[model samples]
Target: MAAKTDDSGPVLPPAIEYAWGLRDRPPKGPRPGMSVPAIVDAAVGVADADGLAAVSMSRVAKELGAATMALYRYVGSKDELLALMVDAGYGPSPGPPPPGTDWRAGLTRWAWAEHDVLRQRFWLLHVPITGPPITPQQLGWMEDGLRCLDGTALTEGEKMSTLLLLTGYVRNEATLASQIAEGSRATGAKPSEMMPAYGRLLAQLIDPARFPALQRVLAAGVLSQDDDPDDEFTFGLDRILDGVDALIGRRAAT
Candidate 1:
């Protein structure tokens, strides 16, 4: 697809235009076996099998059994392909809860849905986000997430901001969760074993006199034990939801 530009500036990159179906195939009839979706699939496969580092244009082309130049006919560049791959990897968001679902439950489901997507496609965490959602699938996820706050007292802008806050929290949590998974695989140790090792390493290296607050935490004996693996994520998400609930309460009061 051709890139869209205006007196203001470029609205959609060529790849995004192709993704959103704003434009058709690039000129000269893109190669017979070459399509944007095919190229992105090849790239995502490479990323999933190895990592982001394995997802160069040439690598994806090799994975597709096409010449590297052939991919350029559709994708434009590696960065463009990365953007397309990210949106494709996310696919579509699930439908929101049935009518009459409370805003808090709906929002919690939205956050967890985002979490699950990222968790499954851990490589997506490594994809750099350049801007807000504009790709069709990305916008679909955004639309579904916004529905969680529908019929609320919050203004449209506030609803959008709240989604940003919650989605950001989900992504941040996903990154850490992915790292922990990777560490466990590398070390052959479970999450429970890893935390205490980390705590012990900290206890030995951290000077209590120099770091009183950390010392206090260590003294509490919390890190030395194997807590629930999901305790941290659960606690953080609950706190964030509580804060959002309080905001809604205040808005309703006013």
Candidate 2:
């Protein structure tokens, strides 16, 4: 697709416009079936199978059985390709919560929907956030999340901020889980073995007198084994919603 030239409004990346259907495919060069979504899907396939490093103009072109230069006719550059890939990778929003669901439950469902996507497509987490949500699917997610707060007393800005906070927590939790799993694989240790080993190592390295709080934790065997993976994620999600609930309460009160 060629870049949109009618720049009367806010300037946006071509891929963003392409995803939104604001840009049209050039009349001639690209192969008959080749289009923006087609190209983005092929690129996502490459990333999913071989990891993000395996994705490049040449590689994606090879997958599509086309010349590398030909890809430029559709995607202007690799950065543009990556952005489109992320939008496609996210697939779609889970849609708004069912009617009558409270805001906290809606946001919880929203947060988990995002969490599930990142966990499955961990590569999406590695993609740098060039800016805020602009692509269609990304904005769909933002819209659904904002819809959760539609009847709330909080201001529009507060609703957006609350979603931001929730998304950040979900991403951080997923990243930490992925990293820990990777670390366990690299060392060939079972996930269940990791915390116990860590606890033992810490016990030998610290002095009870100097690290009394930690010593008590060690004595209590808090790190004897890994907790259910969901336990940590659920705990953090509830705490964040608790704070949001309190704020919503304040807004309703005054």
Candidate 3:
């Protein structure tokens, strides 16, 4: 068969080239004993069972019944493997919204879909973001998010900024949920138990008369029980979308 060409030129990122089946297999080396899918699946399993800390190359190798160094034949480094693992976890872009859907609604659905993925694979929040995402799945999500604003009057820069803002909010919300779960696991105490102890510590450190605002927040029970996590996420997403809508309206008027 004739080698395929990406006639669009060097448009895709390097990692994406691998993802899109553009890279040819090495002709000289022994066939790789470990497949990329196997390695990624093993890594994900380890992470899901014991967290990301347990997903070392050696550990993954053991899971796959391969020699430790054999994994390197398929994946260049642990970092590269991690990138692939994240992309695998991301899966495919969701189906686009039906025609004439409002931009806000499209973006909201996109953000919530991403939030659901992160929530399910909570380790994703803890995976250190080393640099820009280069994986195909990640790029697919980026493309989908950008497409959400296609009918809007926003400039390319504005669209990009809005996507970044939404991504940051989703990541932050996921991190908060992960942290709360971790805290509960470590302390063996419910939020109610921990909240009172935290409040008492704060009371010892700050007099209510001196810090009225802080006092009021404490009294209002903001940090008491663990609030419904979904409610928290919805509240933040609504506020952000409201801000974006306000900006769009201003631009429309001017």
Q: Best-fitting candidate, measured by TM-score?
A: 2
Higher-TM-score candidate of 1 and 2: 2
Give the 10-residue window scoring lowest on summed lDDT in candidate 2.
1-10
| Segments in model 1 whose C-alpha atoms lie over 4 Å from true places | 1-4, 8-11, 24-30, 184-189, 202-216
- Residues 50-140 of candidate 1 have per-residue lDDT tens digits of 9888889888878888888977777778878878888889988877767989888888887888888988889998987766667778888
Segments in model 3 whose C-alpha atoms lie over 4 Å from true places: 1-16, 24-33, 191-206, 221-224
Could you tell me the TM-score of candidate 1?
0.87
RMSD of each: 2.8, 2.5, 4.8
Off by over 4 Å in 2: 1-7, 13-15, 24-28
Candidates 1 and 3, the one with greater TM-score: 1
Tens digits of per-residue lDDT for model 3, 167-250: 999999998878877898898977447766787677678888899998887788776554677888999999999999998888
lDDT of 2 by residue, 1-254 (tens): 12334558576565567678877743235487777777888999999997788899999989989999888887888888888888899989999989999898899899999999988888887887866667888889999999999999999999999999999999999899778878988999988888899999999999999999999999998987778878889999999999999999999999
**Could you tell me how far off, in angstroms, the CA of residue 70 lies in candidate 3 after the best superposition?**
1.3
- The per-residue C-alpha lDDT of model 3 at residue 210 equals 94
Clashing pairs in 1: none
Using lDDT as the measure, the top candidate is 2
Each candidate structure's count of clashing pairs: 0, 0, 0
